[model samples]
Target chain A: MSNPKEHLYQKTAFDLVSGFKNKQWKAAEIAESFLNRALDTNKKLNSFICIPHESILDHATLLDEKRNSNEDLGSLACSPIAIKDILCTSGISTTCGSKILQNFTPYYDATVVEKLKDKDALIFGKTNLDEFAMGSSNENSFFGPVRNPWNLDCVAGGSSGGSAAAVAGQQCAASLGSDTGGSIRLPASFCGVVGVKPSYGRVSRFGLIAFASSLDQVGVFTKDVRDSALLLRIISGQDSKDSTSSSNFVPHFLDSLSIKKKWRIGLPKEYFQQGLDSEVRQALSQSISLLGKNKFEIEEVSLPHSDLSIAAYYLIATGEASSNLSRFDGVRYGYRASNPKNLNDLYKRTRSDGFGYEVKRRIMLGTFALSSGYYDAYYKKASQVRTLIIQDFQKAFEKVDLLLTPTAPFTAFKIGEKTKDPIQMYLTDIYTTAVNLAGLPALSMPCGFDSKKLPIGLQLIAPRFEEERMFQMAHYLEKEFHVQNSKHHIVL
Target chain B: MKFDIQTVERIAELSRLEFDAQEKEILLQDLSKILHYVEKLEAVDVEKIQPTYNIIESECFFREDQISVHLSNDSLFKNAPEVQEHFVQVPQMIASHE
Candidate 1:
């Protein structure tokens, strides 16, 4: 057991694939090891929503047979990865952490899933998330909140909370997650791992269950930056299924890490504001100083519209969410109430019973914003302001190549702490929501720890198609900050 | 930004969501607070600003409408509670104007 654990855990996907190709270790052995580890961790932390053990084993056996016969293997061959429940996995129940689609199994694989298949990647399981990817903490999940491996009492920041927790807990090498308003980075921050939300459309959103169509993006969480680069390399591409996906040539993300120069990393003043925990503030300052010591020039900048991001995101995301979610009218696919005599009752009962409270709240708010007389007053006004927010980033990027901030206002709070108050929960995204709203690339890497020993992340944001800058800077900071030491470790 | 029960009811209808009286009361307060905060957008001077819709650059992307042999009918209706004639069945949509 320990031998398989040593062979599987702490190894990057690329490394595992290489080992499988060289016949150093059988893919079946690696797959069984990861499965056992995942099951063991589930007893400690409920990170998985669905585990495709039998299927994964079957896939691994085939890969092993091919490898033994000296057949060609793709980049992610036999690599163990977890899919966030938001991404549709054909034949697997993709709940989106909501009761409405609780038993729903997508008929076709999402474009990302197809890409992973092309790479011969073994999807280990589907991790939990906030219902419809709505909340900042995993507590909103209908499957129940995923506990942080660091401290079971604390939350794994959501809606990608489960993905982050799984990686932090060493359940899987890497996991794919969706970020609408900092879902991926927040949990990565809380779990003390590395997660990146690519520039909008960098990764196709074809099969990702829409949270906020404009805001939602698929990202990856990994224990190391190299693995994230590898996973993103395979996943990011243009697809006809997603109209928003970019046709621009995808960059060699792995090559981006090798470029070494004295880069200018920005320190945004707006992020270091009131309500930010003092320890987190100090940790970010110290991390900035460390970066400066490493010859990376740290410039202080300002984004005045940063504070208004949460409000704007809520309005815009909910407005779009209200529209996208209208498809689940107890009519087509998904859970329908027992029996409805009329169309109104059908729509009403299915929605009321299917959606969780937070989801309903956002939908109602979104619906109100786009209502007949209120469209111009709310949704239209928000669109205009959103342009201004984008302009703020455009102007700021003119002065600095990349901006930095604390991933969240504080470290992981106790589970159920903010579920009672929706506003307080929304506040958790104060540092992260803006980057999503602006549709820029951002990466959260472990920077330091708070007094209570929870990990704090230093978020790095770069311009559109400038993911290389983020990767290089993050790699530099990873070495400079030394975030992967035993201190960041969690033993399940 | 001031919201009342009457406004909440209307908003719920527009959103096509079903909220009971208790949920409506709670939402009235929450929605009022959110509206008040978002009302700051009105403070910004946008005399000639055009409302932006789509952000990503590029347009006119069209896909050939070829029917690809994808998931089987059984798999498609696996999660549906009601199905008929290889299609999902639901109550007839009574159009608002109907």
Candidate 2:
């Protein structure tokens, strides 16, 4: 018999849950297998900010006791999963990688965390992220940037960078990330794993700390497409708290993957334009070519206002961020300035001291955009452009079943490479941001490696609530290219 | 369109944030560059396009009127920076003579 413990870190959550359900091995054994891997390598990658090492064993033993007693256990019993720091975990410090919330412990669980607990998944640790989910690279984290498992010098892309790196580093079997813009996909591409950002409102945003309320969606990083689909199935449903949460019935994502038909994939002409790294283009071409050979029809489609997406995304996200983040003024929770002279000093000093550089910059821009004289010029204009971008996608989707594009302009850049140039850093999400503007479901899966052996990500976007269709494409492409959920093969 | 120190100070005041001189100098340049980039949005003719305030088109649903213990007062105040008795203490919003 094959030793399940030997490959526990490499196994998918799907496999782990099945093993647990069948009572093939104890849940404590699988949890310890991953705990050992996380403890050994997490220091080097800086993937985990806080690991519930003792809690994992505690939860695992309880799960095992339940199994032994013949008690009912949820679908995912004792499968270890890492959570991004942005999510609220009861009694655990949920910092959102910002000093403002440095030591804040949430009194209640985020809806997603509560859901994972309901399924009996071992909520392993809180991974790092860009402070307030602001930066494109993980460098903006209060905790140090998460290093790409493939190359230590490069970044695991942000703001979901840590979750991506931890999974790629094999520190966890799977992880959850919140994607505002390309936080999940960029890092997933950088680290060579599967990242899925479901349709907006498909999942509850109740427990997630908001960045841009309209754009942010909780997603997952896993070894393969189905694991992502399985996790999505477990987490997505309407919640009483999140009024925006869709009342649409959740679909059976894994079973629905059996739909086999020729998918007419649309290739955006804008994405292949200048500035796309030649190597990335080659990897994208090869992945699409493999799909073409597999009987999937490929055609060139255009999103005319695509180039304008990044600018609109920044204006809209920052504007929303400025409003959403204004609640953090050292009153009810989080870091408070000592001995404030008055209320106004408390607000100014508390924010000035609490927020990091990039976060401050975004807040400044957002404040400027939303400011009276400039609102009609900056925020209003950007909102109008966002409408145009949405229309562009709407028009394109009418003719195509799915759209394929490069997830990022290039593979992981060096940690400090573009930190100085905020504009250059923002360009990393060039291809992926527009999808969020249109509020579509998209998946980023590994296609191939660059000359430097860094992984390239291929993004497949579907019309709203069409994640199953997108996953069908991702699964087929992953099989054909043999790149779905491949491990980073990087030694810490 | 011209992002200057006055503009920075104005926005910073509005944003309730303060930055040192060195940081302010950097913010001036960075904010100017970003605003310049956002200038491209002005070029796109969106005469009749309505701004998308919310992406998902769903009517807000009001829950049945109810009141219950969602969280205890102590748990809600667990992370408060300053709590007096059962209430969150904050700096005086208005100067008061006692």
Candidate 3:
């Protein structure tokens, strides 16, 4: 009835798979549609760093031929999924949005990339991100800032900003983003998409370029809650390569979506108490009331140490980042300094020239924290407070099935709004950081829009390894909120 | 604590980074402000709590000790600034040449 291009470009990945299964369209046709859309708008949005046209079409053509011959098709038979540049794809550059690894191509796929391919999903392209997932906005990217599709003057939140913008712009049906602190959810909230930060160790981190080893987790951004669940089910499972990946059985996440049991949602008193935008607060409270009307119990809970989350998180993340990022010296691989006089110059020049401002700042902050006399005063104290933050969540979950909060303090600010003030930028993820510090699962979905028409994100966090419950609650919330089809209306 | 230029320079040296004079001045102020903000952690009274460096309960996972195929020299040297036969070349380590 409508122009088929609209449906083709905007269909949920689930429907697209169903469309392919019915022989309604060839895999090549679907892949071509997405590639064309991505190419059409990437310049305006700056959502992608590189789009390998030849490789993507070649893979799609092979998939079409196999489909025509009636071969076994995987879940994402023809679906095109965008990966944040941080994920390593074999033979493609995994830059982690830094100049140091600009030309470095990986020889093997990350565990998640392998899983996506195993399910026959097309590797859409590498999306831009904050360099090494450091900054809260995508402006830190070496490529450029990822403009929010809804309002080009505004920024798409980072470090998964490019992935969020790509999904928001209809460049891809869905995408993968990484959340260290609020990387995925912050951007998703800004771009009006569903982003999930799965429980730590729930998904293997074998090939995710480590930001903060303990806090970094791979997550998905999609048009709807169900696609988030589908991707989670596919990518999660124990990988022997990632020693931290849980050996527990990966639960049937998609199957849990149909179970419509009402949940007891906790509204953290601290989250609502301060620094929340009035409009954003109004929308989150509306979503909570809608849940209460739908028979879900709502109760006020306390995370007393919540105010200290940002401080502790920055210390721990940078300390871990300092240790994790030390491997990128001149000799091994990636960008090496041009002409160093000696070994020390080689190390100094390579790192100084290779890393950007925010990366250097964090590395130094971490070095200071972990340095000789300061270790007990800084890093050690922060880690101990980290224990209290974890215990707070553990205790809160005993009272409620999930805790709800705003994914970020405000909607997408204008480009360069918070860049000059690093503290202002860091405060954007205040509510989301504590979840990562505690190692929990959370999701951000479009609840409503602010006065500027930029989307507001509602965050729902669950206990560790309880992603099934997280998905169940988010699925129910989305249905109740009736915010259906609030996706991909990019101005470009 | 005041993060003076000397402290910034020392920390940068420890981090194996060498910033220009202007950048160092900016970093001194930025790091001082950020560190001042992070001073909130010291007030949390972490007297008896044990630091949690990891979340997973599993001890060090032991994979079978097996020699297998690793990355070939070509891929390993692919991004090297300078490469010799199957090896990455770098500047001389000692202060004086041999």
Candidate 4:
């Protein structure tokens, strides 16, 4: 008989939990299967920065012991989950894909890490990311870019690329990612997985290394919609440590997944305009036609300020990034400069040597925007534009329960294709950045595949704090698309 | 929208970063292209709009002033580059009298 552990790595977290309850597989067996798969795939994918093999197996063995004692277990009991390196893990090296923190380890766990541990989820490893979560493609990482499972030559979309790639590659059951201006959704699209970016303040940011305090949010990357719901429920809630975390009730997201309703979905005309790939556009049209046949009212809507999102997002995001990233002075924690001539030399050289090219570019841009004479002309103007973008979404939601759009303009591109031109790279987030600007809950799920067999993603965005509505709609569409079984055919 | 070397240097100083001449030249080109793109924000009229610094509707919360367990000095200093008896070492700030 084939070893049951052989295919355990392919099972969903939800199915793994059920199997555990049925006494079919021990937690240690599941952990070993995933760990073996992860180690074997890391050489090609470069998805994980570090994989703690011994600790993961030990944690799973402890969980198996608990099961033997007939003790009640948490929802995620023994499922192997990967975390984006930006979040602090108490004893593990939490490098945010940068050389600066190569040897730095956090003294305490992030709130999300604590929550996952409480649910008995085995955090097998920390995934790679664009350095400081800056770029649109995974190419900006200091370690190396994560290779797309669908097409090895192409990039897995960024700053959360490794998180998305880990799930798509089946190295981990699910992974956590942080989204700031389409980081999670774009990668989800490229990697053909379900990614959710909850409304701002929906999840606590206590130990998530700050990229843009206003825009950064913790999210999840999963193989399917139901797995996304299960993971999202476990990691979301208010914490006294993060005052910005909403006290709004955290509903059982999985329980609400099957409640089908003929909700109105809006397709913003501007999102479907020029620059979108022909195949992606066709996929969106097919999905819309299917929705129409099912009696869901669909209509064209206008988000007039959509064009200004990239401009405003870069300004505001980089502005906050400049201020937030100033803490890495190299004295308290992380890499420190050697043989500094003076204090100024120490600070300058430490940052200059620590940060990568893209990071320095952003810091310079943000500093210039917030500099003494240019404050009103840049930062204030962008903030006003941000207000208008938020208003655009609010107005659209008045007519429809949710909005549907292509998650990205196209499928993944060749790794070095857009790396030369920063503008070309920034434009990759054109459709996805607006959702973060409005602080709305949005998710990207695979709706169809391109002519080349690369997955195409459809984004459904709902009003702030209304994640349940988004999940219900995505789950419905997921069933209709029947793309659930179309897993990535990457030969490990 | 073109940024010169001096302007790049000034901004880098403010950012507490340093770049060599080649890197600075690239930054100049990149910053110019990016800021020129961002210049589109100037066309929008914002006469009456309030700038949103944050979207959280609730007021700032204050925790109760009770003594609680917190990170110990040992743990806090564990990641410090140079630590000696609970003090983080750094470059000398004041000029010594000759």
Q: What is the C-alpha lDDT profile of model 2 across A1-492, one tens digit per residue?
A: 656466777778888888888988798889988999999998789989999888889999999999999999987787789999999999888999989999899988889999999999999999999998898889998888989999999999998999999999988889999998999999999999999999998999998999999999999999889889889988898888898889887888998876577889999999999999999999888888877887778899999999999999999999999999999999988999999999889999999999998999999999988988988888888888989999999999889999999999899999899998889999999988998888898999999888898999999999999888888888877787773424436777
Please report how far candidate 4 places residue A207 from its true position, in Å.
0.4
Q: Candidate 1 vs candidate 3: which has greater lDDT? A: 3
DockQ of 1: 0.60
Question: CA lDDT of A393 in candidate 2?
Answer: 91
In candidate 2, how many Å is residue A197 off? Answer: 0.5
Off by over 4 Å in 4: A1-6, A483-488
Give DockQ for candidates 1 onward, in order.
0.60, 0.83, 0.79, 0.86
True contacts kept of each: 0.63, 0.91, 0.83, 0.87
Interface RMSD (Å) of model 3?
A: 1.2
Q: List residue ranges in candidate 3 displaced over 4 A.
A: A1-5, A483-488, B65-70, B95-98
Instruction: Give the native contact fraction of candidate 3.
Output: 0.83
- Judge candidate 3 against the unseen true structure and give its global Cα lDDT, from 0 to 1: 0.89
- What's model 3's lDDT at A470? 85
Residue A127 in model 4: shift from native, Å? Answer: 0.3
The weakest ten consecutive residues by lDDT in model 2 chain A span A480-489
In model 2, the clashing pairs are A223-A485
A232 in model 1: Cα distance from truth in Å? 0.8
Q: Assess every candidate by TM-score.
A: 0.96, 0.97, 0.97, 0.98
